[model samples]
Target: MSHQSGHQHHIWVQSHHPVKLEPKLPQPLPKEPTFYYFAYGSCMCPVDLKRSLGENTHHYVIGPSILQGYRLGFYVYSPTRKCGVLDIVPDPKASVKGVLYQLPWRLSEYLDKREGVAQGLYRHELVNIHCQDQVYQDVRTYIVVDKLAEEAAPNDWYFNVVLRGAVTCGLPEEYCWHLFNHMYNLQQRNQERQLRESA
Candidate 1:
């Protein structure tokens, strides 16, 4: 990894209509959830998984230190708040030097809500992440926005949190500056759109 080096495997959430969001995706029974949840956001703040699963939680955060090349975006929208937090998927090429929350076979309502699995915006799936000098395979978690939608734009608040976390997580400045640069570009684009729309 060159810069970014970390990723957001955690999420933002709301209500879910699984059938609507996942027309073809297979649904996994929560009862059989023996996989780990790779947390990259607030869950990364601590081993919240341990709280949710008691002694069942395993592994602290390990990483390829997912560096640059991923874009953090939002899935669920909060109409009343006008701005939602970061919860989108990271680019596959981008790395998420994220914490792995190994969860036991029980439903964590807090995580389910946080990732919006209950909400239609995301559907749970198993994906492998590179971490701890080896390849981690078949871990399960929810991915928001089935296929990233094309927008000529992106979100401001969402990007800030990711950049802040990555930096706080100890990612270097050149890499951090790269994120800020991306933010600057998005801000410019939003301003341009607003100017045009107002006109």
Candidate 2:
């Protein structure tokens, strides 16, 4: 992707990296602190995020966004859902589409919690988002720190959440097609497994 003038983005080549703490907040949190968060997984779905983050989800204003130099992967295991979650792996040749949400800065801590950041599952990092023909710098996002040795395909319901969000946000049809094919294959295998279990 061509870099726009004055927009210098960090080149993240490592898929697994160390965790870092958020910058310490001043004694009194700024009133109405706001942040731009890039959601490239289930969080891309407002319903999914609100299920965990609660009703204040109204605070999020989402728009279609692109993350360059990365590819979405499903190696982040979720103990609660007993399935895999989405994470972006550094890919010099690919770009992933999702949603960019403007949210209150104070909610970052809660988001980190929802992402299991404190458990060393995922780490918070700054990502570059391209939206509205502009490059947004230092946008916050989560990256998996400990990926499962064997990648796990997401369940149908979970994958549907991402598919719905992608379509709702008007992502390119080509991208949606790619996800749809992947989901179809995974769902078929899962159904076969159910048959075997019943047998």
Candidate 3:
């Protein structure tokens, strides 16, 4: 675990977000079948992922990776989390940084359930990811079925989990700062809107 030091800006949130340490090296694939997964949202956090998959996922992580031709947006409200959640939108000039995993096929159904695939909230998107100087093809990721017209603000919990995963997984420092600032700005704007409406 590396920490971001000497940064001028501070993340303004009322709660403590803990980042649990995980093994950097991924476990070798089993004799059973496996599939590649790229996670850009709360799923990036192995702790949260384990909660859904019902198993330890840290060992499944293939580390921080990049996805080209797509950018992140908070385009859907999650009834479960009661907040806006992440989605990937096509953007030719943009790229998303996230965690990549090679997971056993047994966990596939759980993963789909977590993404609300059965309810049609999200659908699989096969993509190519760049990891450790190599390009991985036909990786599975989820995208919003119906995106909001405008971006929405993520709640503090979702925001923190995302940042924790990014930092813990060793994403680029500059990209992490950009993510922090983007979410912070959205939260601040949302708060302001709420205050104005209340007044």
Candidate 4:
């Protein structure tokens, strides 16, 4: 099948069967039923998510959830925070505690912007999550592109924000502690360097 800009390439075709290109729609159509998102990072914080989505966030119903086979990690650098942001790393024996929210399908665009999709910093991916004995499939979440960023320790403010969100969502104390203690103290390390420089 021949590929072109803004055209759908056909997958099934034999030498005898000529490939028929599907015409592009003049306008995009909305797909239903609802949009569900899994927030494993600071987005799990209602305060942060509200700040990101503003009043649009009111359209969502949110609750605590768990994503298995992934663990919380600090690696996505936040220039504004001068530290790393939260990301989920795949692990065979670990799970990440997070929040699950359902919103109107249209609101995905807003969330996408907040996550810097256009900037190529993060991308939306669908994954399964478990909440309250229910398993949710095709729940979208933001994940950092591999090999695009260097791992860095999160600063105090960034770390606290993640901790606060985890606490707010009532994630297990053990998990919360692990999150709180696992991050590196780049701020402190810089302070020590400054002290040494002065001496």
Name the top lDDT candidate.
3
lDDT tens readout by residue for model 2, 56-173: 4644746889999998777777887677778889999998888898887667788999989889999987989998898999999899998767557787678889888778777889
Winner by TM-score:
3
Count: clashes, candidate 4: 0
lDDT of 4 at 123: 82
Candidate order by decreasing TM-score: 3, 2, 4, 1
Off by over 4 Å in 2: 1-31, 56-59, 187-199
* Candidate 2 residue 112 C-alpha distance from true site, Å: 1.0
The candidate with the higher lDDT, 1 or 3, is 3
Question: Candidate 1, residues 1-199: lDDT per residue as tens digits?
Answer: 4333332211112124454546455655433555566655444444334453454333333432432334454434544224443344657575544455455455466566555565565566566665566666766555556543533233665555556555555555676676567557755776898999999
- In candidate 2, position 186 carries an lDDT of 61
In order, candidate lDDTs are: 0.51, 0.79, 0.89, 0.74
Per-residue C-alpha lDDT of model 4 across residues 63-180, encoded as one tens digit per residue: 7898998876665776666667777777989988888888666667888888778887788778999988999999999887752354567777777778888888888899888776
By the TM-score metric, which is better: model 1 or model 4?
A: 4
Q: After superposition, how far is residue 129 of candidate 4 from its true place, in Å?
A: 0.2
